[model samples]
Target: MSDQPVNLVSVNTAPERAKKVIGTVIENVKDKYTIVHAGNSATIDGVKPLLLSIQPPPGILFCASMWTPEEQAEIQQIARETIPGIRTHAIPTGLQVQVGPDGVIKYLMERIDDIMKV
Candidate 1:
């Protein structure tokens, strides 16, 4: 697969845990993908333009917050308006793992791997 960038959007207040999880996740995927730890933003609008400007755009976006179906659809719609063919996947409540650092890292690795396969 082409080495399209992988964007990770994480927002955590805990320094130590965030460092460990984000650090580990970056280390694990850096060799194979161009990992952009897009950092937290006060609003998506603040980062949207930058993300949309990426050369090939990011192939996958791993969000730390779980959005409800309606919210997920809204985000997907907004993204599709800008980039056709983009898709969004939400992790259900039962399988969230946790909305913490670990969950974000886990989801990033798993989903990116799955997307890379396709």
Candidate 2:
């Protein structure tokens, strides 16, 4: 089997516009991406299960949260502390980030077209 890095896109609490952008990304990359719906919960308890449920797991985890700034920080902190090994990114709600297999961000953008370009 090929060992290409798995791309993860987590939608924590997306607004309407953010949802559309996420949808576009998913539609474009679904064949090679793992999508996680995190809803409004940001705690480890809430996110861990979803991560575990993904068969074979992912080499990279991208968490996108549309919550308030305070909540966003809390979520990012929890994810970093709880999940080890794999790469993790706590992206803002309206923005998107493409993470490479080496745990580095390849691209970050607010527009769907820019995200798709990655």
Candidate 3:
């Protein structure tokens, strides 16, 4: 699959409807992401920074391209501002772990083998 990012138009002003259009483009996939381009190749929308997960189907063998690197820090900052010592950890993937203090990501541990080193 290609790593090129897809552009996400605003839902209201887009040439096509959000759910209706993007839906048809990705129906039966049963995944949050859309394959904007196809040909042994796929591209995803930029709104990926807003995505929460890319879960695997029961019969599927794998899932890839989960968290993005951009510091979509608003969500994190909100958590810190609203709460105290609220440690949040999300293992969005089996090997990858995210630990948040309040809301800011303290670190991302992608390999248990490297945990001690980290």
Candidate 4:
């Protein structure tokens, strides 16, 4: 698990009512990664809103921080329960310091590097 690679998925919204979430991951994330861009509909039993449509579950599921710790916990729980063997890591969402994309990306990369060293 220590040597596992990280994945980064970008969820961009579209103007059309159909196909809300474009399941696309950053090409440079790794040689292998999973991108599950589910619809905006709510999930049952307090689970995360997003759903996984891909067959043969992904090896890793990456999550970002939520506005509150409780929300973060809920997302983490959802990922953990949904995929039996998938490992998940959540970094800061840059909301506290209100940083721009570059700063957020730098900080996230640093955090991931630190995690990989462990």
- For model 1, the run of ten residues with the poorest summed lDDT: 9-18
Give the alpha carbon lDDT tens digit for every residue of 54-95 in model 3.
Answer: 222111111111323222233233323433332222223322
Candidate 2 similarity to native, TM-score: 0.46
Q: Write the per-residue lDDT of candidate 2 for residues 41-78, one digit (tens) a residue.
A: 33435766656656555444445544556665665555
Q: Model 2, 69: alpha-carbon shift in Å?
A: 2.8
lDDT of 3 at 70: 28
Candidate 4 segments whose C-alpha is farther than 4 A from its true place: 1-51, 93-97, 113-118
Error of 4 at 84 (Å): 1.7
Error of 1 at 71 (Å): 0.9
Clashing pairs in 3: none
lDDT of 2: 0.46
Q: Report the number of the highest-TM-score candidate.
A: 1
State the local distance difference test value for candidate 3. 0.25
Ranking by TM-score: 1, 4, 2, 3
- TM for every model, in the order presented, reads 0.57, 0.46, 0.19, 0.50
Ranking by lDDT: 1, 2, 4, 3
The CA lDDT at 6 in model 4 is: 37
